[model samples]
Structures are given as C-alpha cells and as structure tokens.
Target chain A: MLPDSAPLSAATATSPAEEVLTVEHVSKSFGDNHVLQDFSLTLHRGENLVVLGKSGSGKSVLIKCIIGLLPVDAGRITVLGQEVGALGHDELDQLRTKVGFLFQSNALYDSMTVRENLLFPLRRHWMADRRGQEESMVMQALDDVGLVETIDKMPAELSGGQRKRIALARTLIIPPEIILYDEPTTGLDPITAREISQLIREVQQKYTTSSIIISHDMNCVRLTADRVALLVEGRCYAEGTFQELQQLDDPIVREFFV
Target chain B: MNSTILAETGAITNFAWRFFRHGFRPRYEVQELLYQCYVVGYQSLPLVGITGFIMGIVLTLQSRPTMAQFGAESWIPTMVGLTIVREMGPIITALIFAGKIGSSIGAELGSMRVTEQIDAMEVAGTNPFKYLVVTRVLATTLMLPILTLLADAIALYAAYIGINLKGVTTLALFTNNIISTLTFGDVVPAVIKTFFFGFAVGIIGCYKGYNANKGTEGVGRAANSAVVVSSLVIFLLDLLAVQITSALGLN
Candidate 1:
C-alpha cells in the first residue's frame, strides 16, 4: 500500500506523465455526517484512475464536488489548473466544456430525443467554427457508441445498456480533456458491464484523455484502471497499479478483491 | 411551524432572487420560452375554455330565478358579464392553471433533479435555471394574462348563449348590455392580478421541483406541494388584488 501523504502514482511500465486533476485534503459533509474527510487523490493525463469504495462511501460525493455540483467543506480541488471552488459560474461553465462527466443514472434528458440530447451540449457551448457541422458531429458521436440507428429515439425508448452508451456518446461528443465516470458499470449485466469497461479503456486510448472512474465493480476496475485508489472511511487509504493493488496484503484492500 | 414556514419563505424568496439575477442576462433561452408558452397557454385552452363556458352558463341559469323574482331579468347579462370579467374568470382560470401547470413543472423538475439530469445540464455548460426555470416562469407570467382574457371572452359568450337559451335577446343587445357595464377599473385590475397569479404558480412550481430530494418520493412531494401551495397562493393573491382594487376605488 502506498503512503496516504504521497500522490497516487501508477506503478505501471508506461507511467502517467502529467497531472490533470488534483484533490488535496478534501473534506465534504452533509451536516454531522462527514462523507469525506481529508480525502486526497490526483488524476494523471491520459490515465484511468478508479476510486474503489463500498456503497455510500462518498464516492459519488467526490465526483460531484470535483464537478462543482457540491462544494467542499475544506481543502482544494484543481481541475486543469483552475481551482474548482474559485471559478465563477461562467468560468466554471467554460471549464466544464473541457471536462466530461457521466452520471451513474446516465441522466439522459427524458423530454429530448437522442439527436437533440447530443446537440444540447454542443449547441450550448457554441463552437462557432463548427456551426454547420452539427449533424456530422452528432453522427460521429453516435457511431462511436454504435447507436447511430437510435439517434431519433427518446431516452425512454432505449435499453439500459443502450442508454449508458448513449450517455457516454454525449460526453464523447465534445471530446473533453478529462472524463469523470461515476459508476459507469453499476447496474448493467456482466457482459454489458464488461463491454462498457472496454469502451472506457478504448476512450482513454482513442482520445488520450485522463479519467477518474468511481466504481465498486471489480471487473470494471480491472479492465479500465491504469491505477486504483482505495477509499476507506473518507480517505485515500491506499493506491497502486491494479495488479500491484491485488498483490498487496492489506485486509481492507483485500476485502474489495474478494 | 412558524419557523418552517419562515424557512420555506426565505428559500422561495432566494430562489426568486436567483431567477431575476439569471433571467434577464444575455444568451436568452427564447426558443425554450416560446415552447413553454405554447405548452402553458395553447394546450391549456380546452380545459380553461370549457370551465369558463360552464361557469358562465351556470352563473346565468342559477341567477335567473332570483333576477325574475326581483323583476331584474333584463339585467342578467350585465350582472354576469361584470362578475365573470372582474372576478370568476381570473380566479378560476388561475386555479385551474395552478393545478395543471404547477404540478407538471414540479414533477418534471423534481424527476430531473433526482436523476441528475439537472447536474448533467450544468456540466454541459448550460445553466439549467435559465433554460428550465426562467423560461417556465416567464411563460406562465406572460401567458396567464392572455389566458385570463380569453377565458373572460368565452365566459361572456357563454352567458349570452345562456340568455338566448330562454329569452330571445338579440346578440347585439346582449353584448351592448355587458360591455356598457364593464369599466376600465373593473377590467384593468383583474387583468393585472392574473399576471401575479401566473408568476406565483410558475415560481412556486419551479422552486419545489428544482429543490426536490429523496428520489421518486421527493418528486411526488414536489408535484403535490407545488399544486397545493400555488392553489393557496392564487386565493391569497386574489384577496390581495381585491383589497388593492378596493383601495383604489375600482370596486
């Protein structure tokens, strides 16, 4: 197990070269219930960091805080060099365009069709040079998820796996510098979950985008994680390469593997 | 109980403040506002129309015997017309609007909140408040007044039909009698109050829905409370409007 004070660096042969996100001694609480206490972790450029934790262990809270949906009670979060809490609404919005977040629920808009849903973020960010190319961009995003045929369908019409893929496609459409996956494989079947995990890996390679994936799904962690950080009681207890973490003798870490 | 009410009032007021802060800024959601207008105004027509017609007919028929007993049957059109335009049209339409649109906005936003769709919108670089709340509130505020006017017209027409159902009063005479009784004071105050009614319904619905919690159950609560609160607010606003109009010697 790595020291808690040190940054969670990958022990793999091809090491992470740059830092894209840093969570330093972050603590968040809802009233007296401290969900995270002095939690610290860093996401490297072009590497997948899976935060492994049990249910309701502040995994989702961490993701929300990073995205500025929830404010941290203490400490700082730096995303692509800008302090998360310090950014204004418009500035945060500008930063958000560079970072993609995939919610566990997929969070596809029920009122809009897939095409409109894909166009929502694209148009909202309003990349002036790409105005007329919206159709092609949407098609490309759909093709990435292999759901181009379901482009016109509402979110309610898609299957669970399809919805997850479409949600991923929506994130990928903008080609963000970093992608945060909050339990990407939480509710899917084993095969679908594996497919999603593989897709996560493929996205990392294709875009060379850094990612922080929150998951208790071991298979997903095994498939997608270049490095793994074990969150225990609102702290980064230990972190290492997935294989290195597996070889560790710590019982708290072993509990996750078993 | 008082503290809870105070807390809720404070929160709603804060929500309103946020609405004003973001509502008038550039990058206006004109398309969403128009769509919401169509939904809030056009789609609500059939129900509001039927209610107005029935109200007009019922008021006319119910008052006929009383008017006959007082030898004032000739004054029925004037009486019904003044009542519909000055009170019943606005209050009844606002109530119906609160029941339908208020509940809808609450449920929709609550569901979106629970499912993280709202956060997704934020992450997509779109202010969900601007896109959802402001558009909806603006739609209700602008559309409610128009809907009230339409309801008043429909009810007056129905009252005319109710008059013709028994007596053979010509359409021209009936209209003239009703129009002659309606002053600017009667029309303007009632029309002005409908805007407040609409704003109340829209803001309350958006507030409940936008702040909803506890998953699906929270959504249910949001929708339920939105209708209840907005309905209550409609009556309160109507009372306040009456007081204001009376104070202005428009009564």
Candidate 2:
C-alpha cells in the first residue's frame, strides 16, 4: 500500500504573486438543476490548486467553463489575461494551446498510437520548428512520464494506470502554462494513484506549471494539493492548505480529512 | 408531438447551416478527407455491387411472366431498362447507401462524442467539426452518387443476363432497344436526384451523430435515427423530383 500523506517539497512552497487564471463568480446550470452557482477560485503562476467535491458537485462543470467548453451562465473566467467567454471559436481554440486539460477518461484518441497522440497537439498549434524534433519531442514526453517504452503502442493496449500516465504525457508534450486535471487519480489502485500523485508533483516542479485538479479522492487531494478548495453545493465552501483544512473544527471540512 | 418534430427539424437545419459555413473555411483536412472517401466509397462498392446485381435480376425475372402474359415479352429489354434508369435504380441504391453509410457515420461520430474525443480535439486547438464532420459529410455526399452509378451499371448487366436466360437477344439489338427506350430525360433527372440523395444521407448522418446525447446507448440511437431519417428524406426528395420533372415535361 502507498503512503496516504504527501509532504510538500520546497519547490512548490513559493508561488509567484501573479494570478494565471481567475474564475470570478461563474455560474452554470443544466435546465432546472444548477450545477455551479457563483463559484470562484484562482490559480497563481506556479501552484497546484485542487478542487474537492462530491461526484456531482460541479467540479467538472467549473473546469469546462474555464476551458470554454461550456458557456458560463453568469460571471467571468479569465485565462492567461483574456476573458474566456469573450473569445470567438477560433480565438478560444488559440487560447486552448496555452492551457492543457487531462480528462478523467484520459481521452486519448483511440485511432492513434502513443507517438501520434503526443504529436497531435504539436502539429495542431503549428510549431514550425518542431518538424525535425517531433520524434525527439514525443520520446522526451514519454520519458517524462517514464513510459518511453510504450511510445508506439495504442492507448487501448495499456493498463488503466499506464493509460493515465500516457494521457498526462500527451498533455505535457505541448507544455501548457496551466494544466487542468479532472479526477486524475480516480479508478486506480492505491499504489498507482500514489505514483500518479508523485508524477503530478514532479511535473509541477520540472515545468513550473500551474494546475487545477478536480477530485473527490482525499488521497489525491492530500498528496497533490498546495491549496485545497472544498466545493459544496456549487460554491467554494472552504479554502485553505491541506494541513489547515485538516485541522478545521467544522464538520463539513473535517469530514474529508477523517 | 408536432412541436417536438418541428423543433428537431429546426435544430437539424441549424446544424446543416453550420456545416455549410465551416465547410468553406479552413486549412482543409485533405488527408482525413481522402481517408474517409476511401472508407466510405471504396469499401462500400462490393456490397453495393452485389445488391445491385440481385435487384436487377429479381426485377427482370418478376416482370418477365407479366410482360409475357400481355404478349409484350419482346419489349422486356426496353421496359426493364426504363424502370431501372428512371426510378428503381436510384431509390434502391440510395436506400442501401443510407443503411450502410449513414449508420456507420452516425455510430462513429456518436462514439467519439460520448468518449469526449471531440471535446479533446477542440481543447487541443483542432476544429473537430472540420476534421470529423466536414470530411465525413463530404465523403458521403461525393461517394453515394458514385456508388449509385456503379450500382446502376452492375444492375443493368444483371438485367441483361436475366433477359438472356429465357430468350436470346443479340447484344447489339439489346443495346439498341435499351438506348432507344431511355431518353436524355430519363437519365439526367435520375442522376441529378442522386446528388440530393447523397447530400441528404451525408447531412442527416452528421447531424444525428454530432448532436447525440446520453452515452453508449446514444451511439446506437444516432445510427438508428440516421438511417431512418436519411431513407425518409430520400423518398420525399424523389417524390418532389418526380413532380418537378413531370411539370417540366422531362418525363
């Protein structure tokens, strides 16, 4: 079994004062059932912010809004100094290159091999100089996630943990300024989950990339979060460091730690 | 119920409008388009060929005894040729095309949507609509008519074999009879209507697949609805084409 606690390293301790992404009072609803209501959060230049919530508590919706996948019903989501809601289709697509998203399902293209999957974004953004170096770039990304051997394999051939790692590698290939991970550690064995948590930390330190990870897994939250925001009933019910939130006396906050 | 159907029709029209708009603008997806054409057109030829052959033979055989009863057995070549050229050929081939191509496109796209592959494409800065929808829709639109034409030729050959089974006619005489029976009006209008049939199949498949909701079940639903809708649209369009052709004295 993997250790339940992850002590923060020195590199992740000092985040720059610049805010990279801000969700200011954003709200979204599907018909009568409102998923997100005036929820708000922020990510600094280099930090891992975890949004903790129950299965249907609007965490995915929040991420969708930030990525401009779903239009917000109210409020503003600004990413990399531009309002996400204000951009046109092409503009939003351009903005997406700077921000990577890791889906809970991994979302690796079923039709493609690992190398092709990694090459997808690099080619899409038209990084002209990446032509000769594309092979090396793919190899290096696979190397980062310690899956260089699986470079030529299809996604379906891998185990769930391996698939997750490959998915992370695919995202890291483009090296986005901020990465959004949706349930990064769910549906994994404890050891694999712990390893992914460590990989997440390694990615943060190496790339100095900010991340907003959505998860209900307390272990993932404890291991990866620099600051944890508890999303309760479509709002940020509480916000603090894991240790700070762990020591809170309130029943709602304490429920997670216990 | 009426309102729901109207809403669906309105939604499909809007979807079609988007397809037209994005289809023209792009760093066009040439590679994907070629691959789709290969899959949709080349792969479907054998099935279309076999169906065409059977349809031709069956129609010839069934019409033989009836024409013989009317002492018009010698007119079998002309009658069969006209029927295949004007109506049965396009409608049967289109319905078959709808069943094969439409359902396949719908299921493929629906699977992509449910698995979030489409969303991943968007988030990765590739236009999913351009890469997936446009390529597929265009492939069907172009491929269906070609398939129908090929099917019509194979069908004509089978009809010839059927005619030769009981009575022998020289190829020259058979060719002359068929040529004399079928006017430019018969061939042109039939061929023209096929393009619309092809477009309907492509567009309906794309629309249903693109807009499918739910999960794995939705994939099946999209495929099912695509065939149903495209087949229906094919008949309706055929009816309208026939009416217009008659009005213009083309038939």
Candidate 3:
C-alpha cells in the first residue's frame, strides 16, 4: 500500500498513458447565475484529480456535467472517448455502466437494504455470464468497503460514515472505469473523513480507475488527490499538486490554504 | 396566479409526454409495479371500505324520513343503489384515495428527489422515471378503478344492512328492486369515468413529486398539493363525465 502521506510526485510518478475523460470549455448556467463558464479539466487513467472549490463554486456541477446528468450550455464533455451531449438515452445508459458517481447525500435507496442497493447497478447493466456470480460480487464489494456485516441493513440504519462507505461500495460493485465522488467527506467527522480519504486512495490503487473528487476539505485533498484543480468563479483558476498550490503566493489559493 | 397555473399546466403536460414516451417501452418494471399495486390497492381496502359503508348507511337513514312522507320507503333500495353506484361511491372513494395514495406517492418520490436517490438511480444505469414514476403511476391508474368498484360493492352491501335495520325486507326482494332499476347506462358510465379519475390522481401525484424542490419543505408541499389538485381534478372530471354521459343519452 502507498504511504498515507505520499506526495503527488511519488504517487503519480509514472503517469498512465490515457485520457479517459475530458471537459473542454464547458459552460453551464441556471437562469442568470452562471455556475460553470468555460471550465475545462482532464482525468487520466489511474489518477485522482480533486476539484477544490468553495461550496457553490460549480465543483458538483462539473462532475454532473461529466456524467451527463446536466447538459453544458457551451462546450463539450467527453467520457471514455464518447461525447456526453451527443449520446442518446440508451447510449448514455450504456456509457454510465462504465462510470460510477457517488452523491453527497449517499443517495442510497432508503427502501432497499445495502445488498439490494449494491445489486441495483449490477442488475441494471447485467451480462448473461455474470448471472450466478452476483452474490459473490456483492460480497466482495462489501468486503472492499469493510461493510459486509451491514449488507442486510437499510441505509437509514447506518451511521453517516457507514452510509458514505456503502455508497462507495455500491459504486465499486460495477467496477466502473471512472468514478466521480461528490463531497465524499463532507459530513463526516475528522477521523471518518480521513478514513474515507485513505479509502479513496486504496480504491484508486486497487481498481486502477480514474477519479474526479469534488471537495473543499483540505485534509482530504492532501491525502487523496494526485493533482488538485481550484475552481473559482465558474472557472479552473489554478491547477497543481496540493503542496505546490499551498506554497503559491496567490491570495485566492492562499485563502483555501489558510 | 394565472401565470403560475399556466406554467404548471405546461410542465405537467411535458411530464405526461415523457411518461407516455418512456412508459410504453420495453424493460418494464414489473416487480416494482406489482409491489406498488399491493401498496396502493390492497393496503387501502380498509379505509375505502369503511368510508363506503358509512356513506351507504348515512344515505339510507337520511333518505328514510324523506321517503316516508311520500310513502315511498320501499323505493329506498333502488334510489340508494343508483346514487351509490352513479356518484357517491366513486367520488368519495376517489377523494379518500387522493388523500392516501396520492399523498403517499408524492411524499415518497419527493423525498427521493430531494435526497438525490433518483439521480443515483440514473447514474446506476436505471431509468428512474420508468422504475419509480411509471410503476407508481400505472399502479395508481390500474388500482384506483378496482378500489372504486370494490368500494361500490361494499357500499351497496351496507345499504342492504341499513334497510334491514329499519324494516324487514327479504334479501331477494331488495336485490331485485335495485337490479331492476339499474341499466347498463347507469353502471357503465360511472365505471368508465373512474378510470379517468384514477389517471388524474396518478399523473398529478407523480408530476408534483418528480419535480419537487426546496428540500424537506418541498416534500410536504408536494404531498399536500398532490391531494388537493387530485381531489379538485376528481370533481371536475366527475362533472365532465356527467355532461358527456348526458350528451350520449346515457344519463
């Protein structure tokens, strides 16, 4: 396992040769309030790119656009080499099987048990050969998240941290090529948040999957991010390693470091 | 106010259009639909049955004194049966259903929307509209009519009990009296309109819930407005049904 405080230089020394996802000059707005304006970023295979921003700085919007949940007003989002806006419903659904998203709320179906929640995506994107292995797959995913004991429990029964872990496990069940985490450590305690940050790194190493994590949590950024992009005023204001950005003299970037 | 109403109308129309487009396609959510049917139809029987029973008994007792003045006490069975089947049973049950199922669906889906469960489903490669909205709408549409019919039967049975409480009338005679006066026009028109009522309740509940916003407060608003709008729609549809039946000479 990689050291908990491994620097970005050591962590991503051998950059994988791939551009799994890209947002090119994407702009999105709700009414007069522009949330994202010409914001662009890239995720290479096996890299954790954290988009650091204050709440409402369009961090979540950028993730949603990448996953095709929200359409961009201008520019394009291409995931796994397919233009998100150009795809049809069926095509998008197919593409989504290769991309997992973890919502800030955990968003586990309240009515379903953890097992059923994990099985939902697997069944939705079912392949005939994997029919009988669903049980094993679910167990393995739960094991990965260290929540196998909570499989039968409803989401409401779990603690906030457990719920967040379960949501991550659900995302990992399908083994998506890319994972988008929206405020994964937002509501957890410091200890749980740090644990989640470590878990994020563990998942990256295990699955070799690209990820875009949206967070303003400095500790989480230090622990999980290989590269951090600062989102400010609906734009990618600065981009660098966490330590590099921390040393920068810019006031806007320093505000976050402070 | 007018603009808000117009905007709501346009939004509902668009939502309905999406439903039609997605609802009829393949990969149907049969399991969810069945589960919803049980929740909406079977679980609601007790409330609907009690309301129907009370309605029948109250109508009989109230009409008894009036009928006695004309020495038409024996005609109570026919009048009560016709009234229950034609209007009272369907309307009262639909209103109650609006309160129960419509609000339930609205709140459930509204909570889902606010909590991002719907978005999660979409990310999971499931069409949440098909899995949640369509199943619920179909269940309400299919189940409401059945519930109304059952309520009508219970009300008629209660009317029989009410009649017996006052004077001893043979069961055969009461049945014959009511059956003889009831025509295909009376039964068919009432039954047919209930389908529309069911559709209205289902569609309106879904429309409100699916678009719910503003968090927990929005959930409450969705549930409350679903019941209110559906109840209003039930009455309006009932009025329209009456006019259509009269025009078609089925009145």
Candidate whose TM-score is highest:
1
Off by over 4 Å in 3: A1-16
lDDT of 3 by residue, B1-251 (tens): 99998999888888888989999998888998999999999999999999999999899989999999999999999999999999998899999999998999899999999999999999887899998888988988898889989999899888889999988888799889989999999999888888888888888999899889999999999999999999998999999999999999988
Residue range with the least summed lDDT across 10 consecutive positions in model 2 chain B: B166-175
Q: Residues B111-183, candidate 1, lDDT per residue (tens digit)? A: 9999999999998788999999999999999999999999999998999889888887988999999888899
Using DockQ as the yardstick, the better of models 1 and 2 is 1
In model 3, residue pairs whose N, Cα or C atoms come closer than 3 Å (at least 3 residues apart or on different chains), thus clashing, are none
Fnat of candidates, each listed: 0.80, 0.68, 0.73
- The predicted structure with the larger DockQ, 2 or 3, is 2
Q: Which 10 residues in a row give candidate 3 chain A its minimum summed lDDT?
A: A1-10
Estimate the Cα RMSD of every predicted model relative to the unseen true structure.
2.0, 4.4, 4.4
Question: By DockQ thresholds, what CAPRI class is model 1?
Answer: high
Candidate 2 docks with a DockQ of 0.79
What clash pairs does model 2 have?
none
Q: Is the docking of candidate 3 incorrect, acceptable, medium or high quality?
A: medium
Q: How many residue pairs in model 1 have overlapping backbones?
A: 0
Alpha-carbon shift of residue A69 in model 1 (angstroms):
0.7
**lDDT at residue A69 of model 1 (Cα atoms):** 91
Query: What tens digits encode model 3's per-residue C-alpha lDDT throughout A103-220?
Result: 9999999999999999888887778989899999999999999999999999989999999999999999988999999999998999999999999999999999899999999999
Per-residue lDDT of candidate 2, residues A1-258 (tens digit): 212222212133454589999999888999998888777888998899999988988999899899998999999999999999999988999889889899999999999999988988787677776777888999999999999999889988999999999999988888899999999998999999999999999999999999999999998888899898888878877888888888778677777788
lDDT of 2 by residue, B1-251 (tens): 99998998998888888889999996688998999999989999999999999988999999999999999988988988888889888899999989999999899889889999888888988888988888888888888878888988888889889989988877788879999888999999999899889888988998888878799899999999999999999999999999999999997
